[model samples]
Target: MALIGIISRELGNLTFLVSLDLGSNKFHGNLPQEMANLHRLKVLDLSFNSFSGEVPSWFGFLHQLQALNLGNNSFTGSIPSSFYNMPKLETLNLKFNSIEGQIPKVIGSLINLRVLNLIGNKLVGFIPTSLSNASRLETLEISYN
Candidate 1:
């Protein structure tokens, strides 16, 4: 258990941040809610860590977000519906977590999405046929329950 302290809120002061990568660290616990203040963020990668707790819904506030990766963590719960509001999103990866539930139908709203990975979770439900609406989608990986 190489875990460190929880994510700090000091990150919120970086209002001009465009890319934030904190993957493969020992950081544990839920992401600070202040992360929602990064309105200019384009790429956010927090993968391969020990982060736990439900994915936050305030992620929708990052309207400029293009790539988001929160994979291989301890996250438990469903994907947030507010994610649909991110019209600029291109890559969304939540693979290898504890998330369980249906893939939201509104996922189709991410028309610019290219890669969607949700593998190795406890999720159970039909693959949303609405995904067909994501015209730009190139790769979709969802396997290993």
Candidate 2:
């Protein structure tokens, strides 16, 4: 059976952690702010969970994050503008959520980004022209807004 419950703030104590995959669980509630302390994280997947609340802006603090997947959750609100700070990010998956707002143009600043999946959200407006600046992007799924 999948795990169910709120993540402990103590999880943030793993300062040397590199990859954390807690996807496909029943975890609900907002992520612990202390998770922002995972500065060395490279891959973080919290998809297919019951987590709600805004995607935390502190995610930007994980500068070493290369792939992040928060798809198929109950999260609401716009993609955090702070995401642009993840300069090394390669894959970002935020599909199948209740998130609203236009995809930020600053997304282009993630020059190393390769996959961006936003297939099922409430995003409106034209795809930002600055996306062309993401020359390394190979897979972009934005269907069913």
Candidate 3:
């Protein structure tokens, strides 16, 4: 596995909005929590890797985040409740992983959410009611085991 530079912080000031495409790479390890510092980030794609560990709890602070894709990895743990604070989230893709736990109730607060994909995971329980609160929700896919 390769160790890549974490450039998330440099983009926090609006000089740049972070976007990562390390998908289909040989990179393996827990995702760095420093990524949460990318407050000005808009898009983040970290799919198709062997990355493991729980999703960072600080993600809720990303008020400017739009698209977030963390699919096809070895990640484990419950979806962070802090994510409910994401103010501009639009699309979220997190399929094919070991993520487990009930969908957060705060997810419904995301009035701008369009697509939320949580397929092929260990997560259990029926979809939460908060999902229905999404006035702009186009799709809510959760294939829990």
Q: List the residue pairs that clash in candidate 1.
A: none
lDDT of each: 0.93, 0.96, 0.79
Tell me the TM-score of model 2.
0.98
TM-score of 3: 0.85
Q: Per-prediction TM-score, please?
A: 0.96, 0.98, 0.85
Expressed as tens digits, the lDDT of each residue in 17-78 for candidate 1 is 99999888889998898999999999999999989999999999999999999999999999
Q: Model 1, which residues run further than 4 Å from truth? A: 1-3
Worst 10 residues of 1 by lDDT: 1-10
Per-residue alpha-carbon lDDT of candidate 2 for residues 1-145, written as tens digits (9 for 90 to 100): 4999999999999999999999998999999999999999999999999999998999999999999999999889999989999999999999999989999999999999999999999999999998999999999999999
Worst 10 residues of 3 by lDDT: 6-15
Compared with the true structure, the alpha-carbon lDDT of candidate 2 equals: 0.96
Residue 20, candidate 3: alpha-carbon lDDT:
54
| Model 2 residue 7 distance off true place after TM-score fit, in angstroms | 0.9
Best by TM-score: 2
Q: Residue 97 of candidate 3: its Cα lDDT?
A: 89
Q: Give per-residue lDDT, candidate 1, residue 143.
A: 91
lDDT of 3 by residue, 105-137 (tens): 888888899999999999887778877889899
